[model samples]
Target: APDSPRALNGISLTIPDGQFLGIIGPNGSGKSTFGLCLSCLLRPSRGKIEVDGLDTSTPEKYWQIHKNVGMIFQNPDNQLVSTTVERELAFGLENLGFPSSEIQDRVDKALVQFDLTKYRKHAPHRLSGGQKQRLAIASVITMQPGLLICDEPTALLDPRSRAETLDLLYELHRGHNITVVYITQFPSEVLHMDRVIIMHRGAIVEDSNPRGVLSDIDLLERFNLDLPPTVKLADALRRRDVPLPAGIVEQEDLIQEMRDIPRGAPPGDHPESESARPDPTETVMELVDVDYTYSKDLPVSTPALHDVSMQITPGSFVGLVGSNGSGKSTLMQHLNGLLTPDSGRVLIEGEDLASKETDLTSIRQRVGLIFQFPEAQLFEETVFDDVAFGPRNLGMEGDELTDRVHDALQQVRLDPEYFSHRIPFNLSGGEKRRVAFAGILAMKPRYLVLDEPTAGLDAEGTHQIEDILTRFRDSGGTVLLVSHDMDLVATLADKVLVLD
Candidate 1:
């Protein structure tokens, strides 16, 4: 019998001291469930998990296992509970019955180590996404767990922030000799791991070194994951009969291959040297002299955007890239009048976006804004209820509502027959994301705006989402995406909009 459905199935693995392991899989492959079981966050129905020889089935042993294991969830907001950075760093110690003196000492040490001393007094919530993620790690580090498990900790962070968080984790692995178990879908991040394990349908499919695993292009495609850039480049070159290393997985390797190419060969003869083909008249989004600021009758409020002129157009996918606190979210909030500009104007169709009487609701209906972690917006009990909420809110009813809900479920790829009655909370992280997306799709919006929609998804989930968005565009729905995925932006966006 399968252990509890949320528990491991034929899953057996061990981490010797000082190992870095990266796990990859499609959504619902039980990667996170396995991690949770190991972390003692969830109990297995039949299988036993042991930490340093302590069986996890016993309450005392479970507690003991937790004392040595620390988990950082995908969302920093879910893990951070302290009002200030200093307190957040100290939270773990305080919970474990550490004395006040020791707790203070750990807090200071963690703050210094994480380079958060300057913001020790600042509220954690006010910190950038990356900063908040660092604080979450700092809080866990204060506990000094022997094994660290991070579940997609950088899923929704900006580029700089993501790099910083990865750097911090790598530092912890090298400096502290902490055994690291990381779950992620970002090929960029995975390439840096010492080892990678690929999971599919609740089982491990491939376990090898990072470079070796990613080089298996066939295996990656089988699991719905993309080859890393280096591997992809190598494969592309190979197809064109260019000489290159078989498992290239980084820029250095690609550069090495290129440098070794025949010195006198024409640039056009080498496929690797070929420039991107130019296309004529690609429509780009344009924003002209737009200014926006928040106000509430008080005089001290700060303006979020000022004279920000930009453009994004048809067949042109663009990224609104920025660090947290750099006004990325606020700017998107203005696209459909969720927040109106006080000065200047925004135009999508060369029409003003500031009129109070314009069918703003209809405008919202056109532009789908999936809030950051759309699960925050899910309120219904059953999957059906949750997905049906949006269309119903739009005044959809009777057979129309039913038909719309069914189509929406299909859009997110959730089987309405199996998932309709399941409680929203019972679904896995990937399932929850789909449910949330289904709610938005039920609205039948013309322009779609998403915020970190794939934060907790695995490689398969991410690919599915990208495909869905592509299809939506193909079906004539305009997309304005907000993501922490630079790779996705590079792969999908026709243009780039660096917000800060």
Candidate 2:
């Protein structure tokens, strides 16, 4: 028998009925595994899990326990198996032997509830990552289990969608008497939980009320987790001896506290002459009067982009932000010549992307676009082959191929020796995402366009990506990043394009 790694190590926790619990931790900290164990999807190596007085370990009680528990996985692709959105929503109901009328009614309600009516007949595999995530949550919640476990269900969602999903979870817990276990990386998402549990290395590191949990800054730092924006800024003011009171975690309170401080240079006051700006002559890519449509069949045709125009300057970081279906991903695809415009011009280095002589292959090589879902980028048998596939096509061999693959893995924090021969499909969701990015990095693109680049990354992994993007930009490369994290975009983007 193969010696598989232990997902949960001596883990124990008890949940009271009708309580809303929030679990927070860094990636690979056993959060997802813990969720799986509690939901009866994965039996623990040594511990027992029970739900609603039924033991999950007992085969006879399996259905009884499964009926009381529902789980939404972190990876949307892994959870979606039905051909269409509607079918996926009805899957659990059908498995529970619900009548046809009941299944249809629940599926119909879910379609409207999650804004999925438009995609009722669309295949889950063909949907965008954010869409699939929404579908996954909708499907599980429709089953109406007594205990719900969600593993980063909103990680791939845009800001508005994430808010809606969280609101729905709160409604289920507060209105429907559901015991909710919400697992997330974002500190703000867990601020309202009745109880908060911080996990590290398959063990509970901290268990306390949300108020007490949020007040401890040092604990968060030790675990490498990001603090809520207001908490972080409040800590900053305290560090500078500004006399700001401690434990201020809300934006309004933090702002009021700043107002009480003696008048001084405004928060961001700086010399106008030294302000940040990039040279206009450094434009590396440009889009003018672009328009694109998908699924030309009259019934399914959808216009993704319209009269969209933008320019990217070398050494500049650009953020593309919008709602879930607001053309952000479609625009990123255009940057790398993946999709030709229905009209207008995409100019990269002064060459028209639509021209037959422009060599689209070379343009794709120069402009790397990582999809919101990383699974699309992986196909080779091993991790090493996947990363090396890019350079290998460019005639790289021997030492050069070895160095490129190794460096790419290291850049993404994956141990080269340990992961080089491993199958890409066996890695965790976050690990798969990183390996995909590394594959693109090996190509050494001059202009990079990433869609939802930090979706599945943890606090530390996100920082590593930021560092890599900054280094690339500082080295005369241009990056057009598409992300829904407003704070991240505001902090790193030299320019922002907001689509309605």
Candidate 3:
């Protein structure tokens, strides 16, 4: 029995039919592994996994359990295998031996449900992060499973897309009464769940109603989970002797509570130490007259960056955020010479990045660019080899390469000895990300550019990443982070960049 390696470690929980449950934890806390076990992706090392009165361990029941439970993985790209959006959804239904007419009917219904009818012929690869995420969900929906388990489904999506996915999930549960088990790292997302299961170090730390669980600031802090902004703002007001209504989790509720409270004199009118509040003049990175377009003659071509100018100065952690089609990815690709501007120029360190044959290698050496879902870039046979890929390519060999690889692994908190020989495919989602970060860190670039670096991490993994970025900045390294996690930006960034 393979009980010792990937054991569940006394996890005992139950979800009744048609109930919605949320699983939360830091990275490697067994949240995803537990979900995978439930979905039959990984056979449990120990313990029982059952669904709809069927034991998962029995061979005959495996097919039955799988037929009733559909799982959507954390990464959109990994789960997606079809070329066109429509075909992707249809493949699952067709494989189940559904009649041709029924298969087509289900596919049409799913497309409408996820609002992907317009993109029926679109390739899954070309769709934006949010669109890809929705397509994955659509494929699962077409299967018509009684139980739906989503592992951080919105991790890579923009704010609007994340919101839309959440809305769709709620609708699926409400209208169809499908049993749903959702996992997420965002504190606000957990606030709406009917039930919450918190995991810590591979065990259930707490399981209760959202309000009861979230109100315990001490427990959440101990687990490195951030309090929702509304709760934090309320706590700040409470510290200042301002009374607020209980159970407020959203800005609207806080606004309502503020209206009910006695009107205090405005800060300018009051003697509340206005001298302490600093003006917002800090800048970290700046771009001027940036002009970029993917193609010149294509009728569908549009400028990815057009006369765009912005500033983010030293020690100012900024977030670049936008919707799916808003060109956020294209804009970032230019930061490290992954893409060049069609016209105009970009400057870093007062040196032009768009000038003729700009020393791109040096530019890249100075700025570490981590792509979206960077974990997928891992191709080496061992973890050490994967992390050492970048530095080795940079001409570091022998002892120097070894030292950089070790240091980078430690920076991401991955155990060097245990992970050195481990294949990247065998690592968990969170571990793979840290490995990706280690690869970039091995280069020791002064300015780090991350694109959705924490895309699929849970609360614990997100915390680890936030700590890593903060430490990088404190050490005098600048970071140009591209992410859709606004809450993360609000908590860690000194500035915010909204791409149109």
Candidate 4:
């Protein structure tokens, strides 16, 4: 244990009161570790962290530090403990010993502010991914700490929800003067921060204002970080003699610059569309008038899917998109018989799922489904065991099993030598997702059903997922991807499916 690698090495930084800071980095770069140490959740190995003139390493100061600092974890499931959404918001307030009436008032305000009033009485676990994220933030904000540290809080949200969350954080920073430390993979999200810090290999690589750091395309590329689309477009244009000014990171700025340039005549002809491909004669998976309702016989039953029907042909990539709690996840679960339809039928390769002759084990082996949260599926002691679980269960062993795990980890861009022996729980959010993906990839499934596979991944990690999906499709495997990222879906999917 003494020889183990340090998550944060000789890190020294200071944050003045009411200053909003942003931190970005690639997967496993110790951003989350730094946040834990700052919040006193994790003690530093060799250095000291002080907040409000109080040392974090001092046990007597921990309570005061916790009282003034609140953290929203990357995984909402880890922070959520109450049975209901309303109770979750009040749990912290009650712990801090707020009066009964004041607790009720704060809970009501949080429920309304986060747009969770509709699901006030619903169980926290039963909420959708975005809903759970909102609950996590609400629970933390209800306590109203002076320093708020958010770790990729918007990774699971849809576009609208993402914008709303950013706006909310900005408002809190500007209005309440809360010292905010926001950690995210999206460079675009940090455009408004007072300062930005880039971390890699457990060290701060760059520290400067957002514009100064983000405008450096070469610097971001060196770290395997993603440049905003507008910034990339501007850089490409400038390279081709477009003469665009520097520091163009926002969409509006780019648009204004383009408007100032002289416009040429409209193009004479639009680009021709690609030729339409013929439909497949056989459907690999199909849902026929399927319907499902959770807690069907209970008084508080909730309907999920209604008369859903679709077909997935062999070797085709299909994109599924919808708002949170719009049955996207519920629909994905039906593909592999994880949840049977309350009415109608699910057919896998022409075999009815409800039929006694149909084997669910075979269906699962052919179709590998990755849940939205990687934490739900990862439980092994080490990364090697987790990735090897699927293959070993199918009778693989010895050198063959070892090779399968190694190859799978390599495919996800994680070095087998470095990650094999590490605990899966200790990895960053993006790393955990990749490990779960490696587990599914090791199974060699014919069909890959992924729900938000790239949710918490960085730019390089996302590109790797795109490459993997493309390779899978080219190799005669079918894919049904569920994601809120429209650009990704457009680039990878052959066809798109919308769920309302």
Top candidate (TM-score): 4
For model 4, give the 10-residue run with minimal summed lDDT.
266-275
List ranges where model 4 is wrong by over 4 Å: 239-241, 265-281, 297-299, 381-385, 396-432
Model 2 over residues 175-239: C-alpha lDDT tens digits? 99999998998877888889999998778999998867777898888898898888988897787
lDDT score for candidate 3 against the true structure: 0.80
The local lDDT score (0 to 100) that residue 187 gets in candidate 1 is 61
lDDT of 4 at 492: 90
* Alpha-carbon RMSD of each model: 4.2, 2.8, 4.1, 2.7
Q: Candidate 3 has which clashing residue pairs, if any?
A: 26-460, 27-461, 283-312, 283-313, 284-312, 284-313, 285-312, 285-313
lDDT per residue as tens, model 4, 346-463: 9999989899999999999899998877656899899999999988998999999999999988877899999999999988766787888889989989999989988888888788
Best by lDDT: 4
lDDT of each: 0.77, 0.85, 0.80, 0.90
lDDT of 3 by residue, 1-500 (tens): 44445435788898988888988777667888888888877776567888888877778888888888899987788888988889999888877889999988999998898888877876787676777888998899888889999998888788777888889888889999999999887767877778998887688989899877777777777887778778878887776778775567778889988999878663333454333224445544457787776545654344567888877566556688887756777777777777777776667666678677668788887778888778888999999999999889878899988889999999989889888889998887778988998998888888887788877666667878999998898787877778887778877776678888
Q: Which stretches of candidate 2 lie over 4 Å from their true place?
A: 1-5, 256-278, 373-383, 406-434
Estimate the TM-score for candidate 3: 0.84
- Lowest-sum lDDT 10-residue window in model 3: 268-277
Q: Choose 1 or 2, whichever is better by lDDT.
A: 2
Model 4 RMSD to the real structure?
A: 2.7
Q: All candidates' TM-scores? A: 0.84, 0.91, 0.84, 0.92
**Which portions of model 3 show Cα errors greater than 4 Å?**
1-6, 245-247, 250-252, 265-316, 340-356, 379-385, 406-432, 458-460, 474-476
